[model samples]
Target: MQKDLIKELCLTQDLIDIAGTGTASQSSTSKWSKENDAQRAVSGKEFKDFAFHTDMETNPWWQVEFEMPVAVEYIIINNRKRSPFDERASELSIVAYDNEDNEKLLHSGTMYFGSEDRGCPLIIPLKGNVSLKKLRITLLKEDYLHLSNISFLISDPLRSFGDKPVFIANRGDGLGERLRALLNSMVLAKEFDGHFIFSWPLSFSKSEFHAIDNPENVFGRDFIDSYLVTRDVLNRCEIKDLRNTMDFISCDNDDYKKIGINLDQNSLKNQIKDKNLQPKNLISEYKLAFEKINFNEGVTEAINLAKSVQLKDKVLGIHLRTGDIVYSDYRYMDRYYNKVVPFYTVESLITRYLEMGYDIVLFSLDSSACRYFKDKYGVVISNDLIPEEYDDIQRAFFDIVLMSRCTEIVGGLSGFAILSSWIGGSKISTYKKILSEEEIKSSFTHSLSENGVLSSGFISPLLKSFSIAHYLQSFKDFSSIIERIELLKKCIEIDNGNNYYRLLLALDYYKEKNFSAADGILLEAVNSTDKSNIKWLAKTKFPKITILSIYTLELEKYASQGSIVAAYVAFLSRYYYDEIDMNIAFYKDFIQKQHNNKNSIDTEFLKEIQEKVNLKAENL
Candidate 1:
C-alpha cells in the first residue's frame, strides 16, 4: 500500500469462488475443492493466483494500470515458471495515454531472461517532470505456455551529486606522450569518476575540440568534467628557455611575495583594508596549490621513455604523422599532400637513404601507414619492438616517442612533428611551399586587390607556413627553413622519384609566381614513376579552379601596374576565361536567380573576353 512498495498479485487466488464454466476433464475443478477454493480468495491482503484450463490462441499478456500517480523510473516483470512460454519474450512496449486521448510511446526494448525469474530490469529515465496514472505493457513472445507472477516496484528518481571536472596537465613539449600516459593512469586510478587530463600541443585543435565538446555530444563526456593545468615553474622553464603563454596574475602584491611574483607587497595591504586577504590573493593561492601537485607515475614513465631514447648518430629517426587536422576542407588537404609532402614523400626518402648504403631505422605515429610502407617498400620500421601498452595511447604519443628516438626527422607539417624535432635535436625537413612573413602580413591587401577571388593554393600554403613558424619559434637558435630545404635535397638525391617533394618545390615556385620553375618541376613530377594519388594531383592537375581564379586576379594587378606585356595579358585573360566559363556553366541554373550570383564582375569580364575572341576569329 506504500507509494514505493513491491506488490505481487495472483489472478487465480484472487478469483477463487468465481469459477468459469468448463468440461470436468479439461478444467481443474477438483483441484479447487470447496475448502481449497475458499482459501483462494481474491483479497487486497493476499497475492492473486490464476489457473488456466487451456492455452489461448492469441499470445497471453497481462497489463496493469497504476492505482495512484507514479513516476516510474524502472520496471521489472518476473515470469514465474521455469519455462514461461513457447518462445522467449522478444519485445516489450510501454505506452502511456494522456487524458486528451493522445498516446505517447514511452519506452520499448527487448527483454533478456536472467536467473531468479528476475526478468532483467529495464531502466528508463522518467525525467523529473511528468506523472503517469496509466501504464500498458505488450509482450511480443514468451518461452512457456503460461504466465505467472507480474510485480511492479515504483519509486522516486535517483540523482547524482558532484562537480565532474576534466583534468588537463600541461607538461610542455616533449612531455605530450608522458602527460597522456599520466592522465590515462590517473583516470584509471580515480575509478574513471572524472575526465583525465589531456596534454596540450595536442595532435590538432579540431580533434581536441571534438574530444571535449558538449557532454551529450561526445562518447567519453560522462567520465570527464573540467580541465586542469599545472603551475608555471619559472625556474624549470628558464633552464629550457620556455615561457608560459598563459597569464597568471596576483591581485595583492603580498599574495605571492614569497614566490617573488609581486614587487609591491605593502601596496595591496594598504589598498584593501578588508578583514581578510582580497579575492585576488585568494585566487592566487588557489592557483599555486593547483599547480604544485606531484607528477603522476604514468607521466614519469613517459619522461623516462623520452630520456632513454637518445639521439645516437647512426639512427636516422623519421617521425611521420599522417593524420590531418583540417580533414573536412578539400583545400587544406590539397595544401598538405599536394603542395606539401604526401605519404609517398617519406616512403621515397627512406628508400633513397636505404639505396645510399646507410642503415635506416624509420618510425611513424601512423602504425597503419608504417605497416603499409614496410610491406610495399621493404623498409625496416622500428616501432615493431614497442610494448603493446605503450602503443595504447593516442597516435600523437606514438609520434612523439618515434621522434624522440630519431637523429634526423622528416614529415608533413604538424605541431607535434615540430615539437619532436625540437626535443630530439634532430634536423627537420618538411614540404618547401611555405609562405613568407611579408606575404602573410599583406594577405589582407592582396585579398582586397583580388576583389574576393582568393586562391586556396595560396591561402592553404600560407596558413601552414604560419603554423609551422609559430611552432618553430618555441625552439631558439635552430629556426631555419633553409636547413629543411637542404635536408629535402639530400633526400631527393637518394630517391630519384620523390614526386611529393618535387611537387612541394613546384608549389614554392608557384607561390613566388615563378611559372617557368613551377612548370618545370610539375612536368618532372607528372612524368615520375611515383604512382600515388597525391603525386597525380601535383603533376597533371592544373592549379585548383579557385587558385587559378586568384592567379588570374594577381596577373590583372600586374597588368594594371604597366608591367604586363601583351603575352602576359593574353595568358591572364585566357586563364580567367577558362575558369569563369567552367564555373558559370556549373552553376548556370543556380546563377539564373539574382540571389545566387557570385562575383558578377568576374563573370562579365570573362563574357567580354569571350566576345572579343569570337569577333577576332570572325575577322580572321
Candidate 2:
C-alpha cells in the first residue's frame, strides 16, 4: 500500500528578486553615469535597456550591494541583441560576498547566446545555499563589459509553509483538468503570493494521457525527475506529508475537498499565524519561470514544429474546441468554462478576418472542424489537425503551444481553447462565440440537454466543490461537525465510489471522538474498495481504530497475515475491553502467535505499548 510521491514544487513562493531593491555601482561608467547607468540593468526596461560600460580596465565589473545578507538563486542578464556584442559576455565570473569577508564564486561561464532572441535573457542560476551582502558580476577578460537588464532573484529560506495559502494540485484526472487546475492555481498563488505543489496528479492518476488503460502509476519517477527538476533543486525544500500534519487548510476549493479537507479558520486547533508572510505580487517571477520550467523531449519537438510553421508576430491563434464540445446555434457554453458563453459559427469570424487581409491558423481538438477554412481561406490547420503520430498528451501540449506562438490568441469558450492564452507574458483573451441579439432571440435551449452542455454548469467543478465546502464550514457550533458528517454520508450515497468523501465522513466521526462511527467507515473501506483507498485506510485510520474492539473479524484475518499493527491493536483491544479479564501477557502471547514476528518500527512501537499495558495492570 505504499504510494510514491510525485513532487514538482516551485521555489518562488513568497520570495522576490531583490536585485532591483539594492544599490547599484560599477567600476567605471565612461559611456554612461556611474551611479545611474548600472541601475538600468535592474530597472526592468526593454526599449533602451543598457548596462554600464567601464573604461578599458582589467576585469571590468558591475556590483550591487544589499542592506542585509540574502540568498540570490538566479541572475538573469538580458544580453544585447546586436550581433557579435551579444556574445561578448563570454568570460564572466559572478561572485557573492559580505563585509565580514565571507565570499563565494556563484557562476563562472561563457554566457553564450542560445536560440531565444531579442528579449534574449542569459540566465545564470547560482545553485549554492550561501547568502551574501553584495553580488558582483565581473568580466574576466580585459575589455568593456556591458549587459542589459540584469535581474537577481532572491529565494530566502522556505521554512514556514504551514498554514499558508496553498493551491494543492493533486487531482488525478485528465490532462485538461490538470492544466486548468495548474493555471487557476498559478493565477491564485500569484494573486495571493503563495505556493503550488504538483503531487499525485502526475504519477498516481489515470493515464488517459500518454499511455491509456493504466490508472495507478501513470507518470514514472524517472520521468518526473527528468528535465522538470534536478536533485539539487529537490533537496532545497522538505516535503511535508499533509495527511500527518495539516496546519494550514486556508483554501475552500474542490482541490482541497476531494482530498478530504475543508478550511475552517475558527475550527482549527493550532493554526500557526506566521508573521513572516507579506502578500506580494508575482512580478519578474515569470522571467524566472522562463529560466526554469524545462520541457521534456515531446514538448521540445512540439515547440520545434511550431517554429517550423513560422506563425509570425501579428498572426492570430484560435482554439475551436469540438468533440465532446459541440458549438451549435443553440449551444454556446463549454462544460469546463466558468462563465456564461455564446456559441458561434466560427467560419463567419474567419471569413471576416480573411476579408480584412489577416492570416489565421485554426486549432481544434475535434477532427471534423476547420474543413471550410482549410479549403476556402487556405488557413493552416495546426499540427495538420493534431498530428496522429503523437499520443493524446503530446497532441494537447502541441496544440496549446502552437497557439501560444501567435501574438494574439482567441479560445472560444473552451478550457482546452483558453489554455494557450496563458503561456505568454501578457494574458490575451478566451475567444467568445458571441451571437447577435436577433440570433440569440431565435436560438433554442435544446442544447442544454446535451452531455457536454450539461457538464458545463454555471460554475467550474473546483468552484462547485468549494460551494459545498463553504456550506459545511458556515455552521458555527458542534452542529457544524455533525452537519458535515451527515452531509458527507448523503454525498457518499450519491457518489458511492468517491472514497474521498467517505474518508472525509469517517475523519469527521474520528474528530468527534466517536470511535464506533469511525470504525464503521474503516470496516466499509477495508473491503470492496480501491486498493489505494484500502491502503490509505490501513495506514492512517486502521491502526487508530483497532483499539476499539478489533472492530470486525476481518481484523483477525488481517492480523493473521503479517499485519503487525493489526495484531498489536487486536491484542490491546482484547486485553483492555473486548476479551474477559486477561493479563497483558496473555494478549501479547496471542499477538506473537498470530503475526509473523518481524522486527519493524511497528514491532518496536508495539513493545513500548506492551510496557504501557503492563504498567496499567501493575497500577490496577
Candidate 3:
C-alpha cells in the first residue's frame, strides 16, 4: 500500500505495426514498372526508405488487404515528397472493406501539409468502429500517386475511446518535468484507450537560455536511442518531430497560465480539462511504467539509493526549482515567474506537517532553499543523497524516486511538484502567485517599448512579429491613432522585411482615412508579399492581410488564405463604398468556415475585431 514503492513494469497499452504483414497490390492494367510495385507501401520501413509510385494516370489507386481484420482508430500516411507539397495527395479518398465486403468510406477530405508535417505522420482519424480486411486509397485526380509509407494504429481494448491522440511535446524542459507529461499521457492513454507520441529533449547539456541543440539534431535518431532518453515500450516517437499543427485533436504540454496574445483559449480548454486529469492514479501508473526499467544498471543504482535513504513511512517532501536567476537584465525571469512560491507562503504547511510527526525530504534545484529547509527542520537532503558521481538523468530520477516516497509535499506551481505528488500518493499543496490582467500582459520575457507592448520568447520569432503587430493594434489604454501609427513605423524600421507588419500599418493608415499614407504602405506591402515565403518558408500559405480598396491583383489571388480579420476588413471597406453588405447570418457563416484556418494571432485579432463588428452590426 506504500505510495512510493517501486513495482514491476505495467503494460497497460500495446501499440504494434501490422501493415508489413499485409499483401499490397495496385491496378493490374497499369503500365507502371515493377520497381514502383505496391508491396513497397506495406514494407513498413522508415519514411523515405521506399515508396509505391505510379505514373501520372487518371484515378491512380493502391490497395492493401490486411492479413487479418483488426480494429483500427488512425491511419497515418506519409508522402514521398514533403516539400513542394505532393498536391496529388492533397485531395485524397480512402475506402475500407470488412470480411463480408461491406464497404466503409474511411476518409475523404483535403489535407494541408505544412513544414511541420514534413518527415512526420499525416495522422487521419477513422470515424467510428472499423474492422478492416482490405483498404484502398486513391489520389482522386489525374496525378502521380507516390506514397512513402502507410501505418495503422489498432487497439482493441481502447477501441471505444477512438481518436483522442496525445503528444508529449516537451521543448527544452528537464527530464523530471517532461516525465510528468509523459506519465500523465500514458495514464490517459490507458484510461481512455488512446495512443501517444513524444519528442524527447536532446541528451546534450542544457544551455543557459537556448535549446540544447537545434530541432534537426534534437529530433534525430541519436537522441531518440540515447541512454538518457526514456523509451516507450509500446509507442516511442519512431515517427519523430510529432508536430500537431495539422492535427485537430491532441494534448500537447502547455502551462495554462503561460498563454499569451495569440493562443487559442477555447482549444486549450478542450485539451487540458484539469478536473478529470489530475494524477490521482499516477503512483500506480509510474510503478507500472518504470517497473521494467529498473533492470537498467543506472536505474537499479537510483532505486538502491532510494532504498538506502530508508526514510520513515510518513515522510514529507519539499520540491523547489529555480528556472532562472533574478539577473539584472531580467530577460530570463519569464521562465521563473509564477513557478516559484515563496518559502514564507508554505511555512504553515511545513509547520503543520512537522506537528503531525512526519519525516522530511527536501528535493530542490535551489541550493539555498535546500539549506534553509535542512536548517529549519533537519529534512533529508536528496541533493546529497547520491553518494558520488551521477548521470544527469539518473540524478533526476533519483530525485523523482525520493520525492514519490514522501507522505506529503510542499512545492511550487510546476509539473515537477504535481507529478511527484501523483507518484508518491502524497498530499501536495502548490502556492501559485496571482497576477492582475496588466501584470500578466507584461510578465513574460519580453522587450517592452515605451507604449508597453511586449515581444519576446513566449512566441516563435515568426509569430512574435505577427502577435506584436496585433498587440499594437489593440493597445486601448495607451496610444492615440497617430501615436500607434508612429509605433508601427518604428516596428517596420526594426524588421524592415516583414510584410505582415507592413500590411498591419496599411490597416491603421486606412482607419485614419489617410488614403495617401495608406496607399504608400499598401505598395510596400504588395511588393513585399512573397508567395515563395508562403510556399516554402513555413509552407503555411498564411497570406498577409490588408483593407486598402486598391489592393493588388496578387493579393486578391490569395485572399482566401488570409485570416477572418482580412475578410472582415475587406468586407467592411466594400460595405462603406456600398460595394457589399453583410447580415448576421452571413457573418456567422463566414466565421464557421474560416475558424479552423485561423492561426493564434488570428484568434486574438478575431476576438477584438469580432466584438467591434458585432456591436456595430447590432445597429444594422
Point to the candidate with the largest TM-score.
Answer: 3
Candidates, ranked, lDDT: 3, 2, 1
Q: What's the TM-score of every candidate structure?
A: 0.29, 0.34, 0.36
Clash tally, candidates in order: 22, 3, 1
Q: After superposition, how far is residue 113 of candidate 2 from its true place, in Å?
A: 64
Say which prediction, candidate 1 or candidate 2, comes out ahead on lDDT: 2
State, as a TM-score between 0 and 1, how close model 2 is to the true structure. Answer: 0.34
Best of the two (1, 3) by lDDT: 3
- The local distance difference test score of each candidate is 0.36, 0.49, 0.51
**Model 2 global lDDT (CA atoms, 0 to 1):** 0.49
Off by over 4 Å in 3: 1-172, 188-197, 208-283, 292-295, 323-335, 344-349, 432-620
TM-score of 3: 0.36
RMSD of every candidate to native, in Å, equals 21.3, 22.2, 18.3
lDDT, model 1: 0.36
The digit string of per-residue lDDT tens for model 3 on 327-391 reads 11121112233444433333444555678898777665544545545665676678787756765
TM-score ranking, high to low: 3, 2, 1
